[model samples]
Target chain A: MNKRELAKRVAEKCGQSQVVSTLVINTFISCILESLEAGEKITIQDFGTLSVKQQKKRERFNLATNKVETYLPYDYIKFTASKSVKIKQKEKSVKKE
Target chain B: MNKRELAKRVAEKCGQSQVVSTLVINTFISCILESLEAGEKITIQDFGTLSVKQQKKRERFNLATNKVETYLPYDYIKFTASKSVKIKQKEKSVKKE
Candidate 1:
């Protein structure tokens, strides 16, 4: 399902209009991205944990060039699904402090 | 940040009460988890794309046991960040079909 369909579901569950649901979801997305970009870890209850991991600079052989290439460090997204994930868990939301 | 803190930020941004905001955010999380569990790919505009990827069975050498172990296939979550992820882009919501 896409965002619109997801928004509709959320709106129905929360008894809110789609517009408002979408707005709140948008804000949430922004917050998550901002937090992750700052190298912060976020753990939601039913959902898994999300964090940014960095890779160290490494050297690899370039087959095409037949030369050793050094790759600079980079950041990537990592998600760990909650071990307790279940249909029943859907009612439960993000993990709390 | 934890869920409560995230909810507070979302509430402030959407001008919704903390209760309503939390409810909406919870619903959204549930929807996302359900979709992902069902092997659906979800892409939010400013955020990123999420999908379930299957890992093929593989063999790995166990140094402790000094033996080769076979691993079964499994599904894992994958998130790909958007190309246009920016602070300003947060204003935009999920990607549209």
Candidate 2:
């Protein structure tokens, strides 16, 4: 599913127009990005937490090139799903199995 | 930050009422949860992808009791940030350094 499909579903469920849903989605994304860029975390109930973790600069060997290179440290996003989500997902998968 | 803070920022930026913004945010989260429950991946542009990964059941030894236990399989959510987000985060960290 992409943004358009998600927006459609949200609009239907929220009884709102797709245009407004799309705008809200955009705003939501923008807010997350801004917060992460500012080194902050966003915690949404029953969803997950979005945060950035800074990795240390390290040397890694390139398998294809057979050379060692120093990679600069960068921040990466980490998301941990809520316990309720985890339980639900596990239940579904177990039923499928 | 929490959901309320996020909704406040989004409402301010989108010039929408807090009630509407909160609704949108809730809908956004619900949409994601529903998609994941249905085993679908959501890809938001310039944000990241949300998907579920199932792990196989395995046996592990308990550290404290030293007893072997079988752990049930579970599904987990994974998120990977966009290249633009990575670059921006790196730049900010470099400036701080």
Candidate 3:
């Protein structure tokens, strides 16, 4: 499911109009990404933690080239799901509420 | 920032009430988790791809125990960030809209 489809489902489940749901969903994404870009560690209840992690530069020797290649340092997003999510994964199916 | 703080920020940015924003945020999380539990891959544009992945079982020698250890397979959530998000990370500051 993409954002559009998820928005529809969210709208129906939350009793909100499609327009409202779509707007809020888009806004939420923008807001979260903005925070993430700012290097904030965001923790969503029952979902996960969103943060940026740095991968240090490393040098590796290539047997074929017989030279060391240095890789640049990098920053990337990391998400660690909440324990509940893991429990749910084990459930194999969502229990309807 | 946790969900409460995130909801407050989202509410301020989206011009929604704190109550409404909180409700919508909670609902959105629940909706996404429900789908994830059902084995659906969720793709949020400009954010990332959310999916479940499995780590297969393997045998490894335990140096301390001096024996072979059998590990069971494990399933976990995986998130891959979009290219735009990486670009945003480089921006260091969000462009005010």
Candidate 4:
């Protein structure tokens, strides 16, 4: 589902208006982005953990040009779903087959 | 940061009470988890995309036991950060070096 639909559902679940729900949702997203940008890890109960992982600078060969290039290191967000969620996923797969 | 801290920040940003903010945050997480469990993808603008990925059933060797084992297929949540977030990460790395 998209953001709008998700917001609607959240609003209903929280007994709030759509506009307020949207604002809350937006704030939630910004909070996560800000935390990651600041190199902080975020852990939501029953959801998972989100953190930034840095990759080291590396050299790679260009097959076509036969040249070596250096790629700068960068960071990326890593998310690990909660064990309950993982178990639920496994159960769903088992049911499907 | 943990869920309580996140909710506090969100509450302050959205000018809502801590109780309501916590409720909204909980609902938001539940929404994503439910969507993934239902095999739906959730995309939040400027944040990232969350989807469930299914792994095919396969065979693996148990090194200690030295026996072949059949592993059942399972599903996992995959999150891809937004382009802006990626660019920001690269810039942060550049500054550090």
Best prediction by DockQ:
2
Q: Would you list the clashing residue pairs of candidate 1? A: A44-A95, A45-A94, A45-A95, B45-B94, B45-B95
- What lDDT score goes with residue B10 in model 2? 90
Candidate 1 segments whose C-alpha is farther than 4 A from its true place: A86-97, B86-97
Q: Could you give the fnat of all candidates in order? A: 0.58, 0.67, 0.53, 0.65
Q: Tens digit of lDDT per residue, candidate 2, span B1-97?
A: 9999999999999888899989988988988888888888899988999888877889999999999998877778989887766535634576334
Counting clashing residue pairs in each candidate, in order, gives: 5, 0, 0, 0
TM-score of each: 0.80, 0.85, 0.86, 0.87
Instruction: Tell me which of candidates 1 and 2 scores higher on DockQ.
Output: 2
lDDT value, residue B80 of candidate 4: 90
DockQ of 4: 0.60
Model 2: per-residue Cα lDDT over A29-87, one tens digit each: 98888888887888988888988887888899999999999887777899998776653
User: Residue-wise lDDT of candidate 4 within A2-70, one digit each (tens)?
Assistant: 899999999999899999889988998898888877778899878899998888889999998899998
Estimate every model's Cα lDDT from 0 to 1. 0.78, 0.84, 0.81, 0.84
Question: What are the chain A TM-scores for all the models, listed individually?
Answer: 0.80, 0.81, 0.83, 0.83
The sequence of per-residue lDDT tens digits that candidate 1 reaches over residues A1-97 is 7788899999998799999899999889888888886768889886778877766678999999999998865566677777776422222232333
Q: Model 4 segments beyond 4 Å from truth?
A: A87-92, A95-97, B87-92, B95-97
* Backbone clashes counted, model 2: 0
Clashing pairs in model 4, backbone N/Cα/C closer than 3 A: none
Worst 10 residues of 1 chain B by lDDT: B87-96
The B-chain TM-score of model 3 reads: 0.84
- Alpha-carbon lDDT of model 1: 0.78
The regions of model 3 sitting more than 4 angstroms off are: A87-97, B87-97
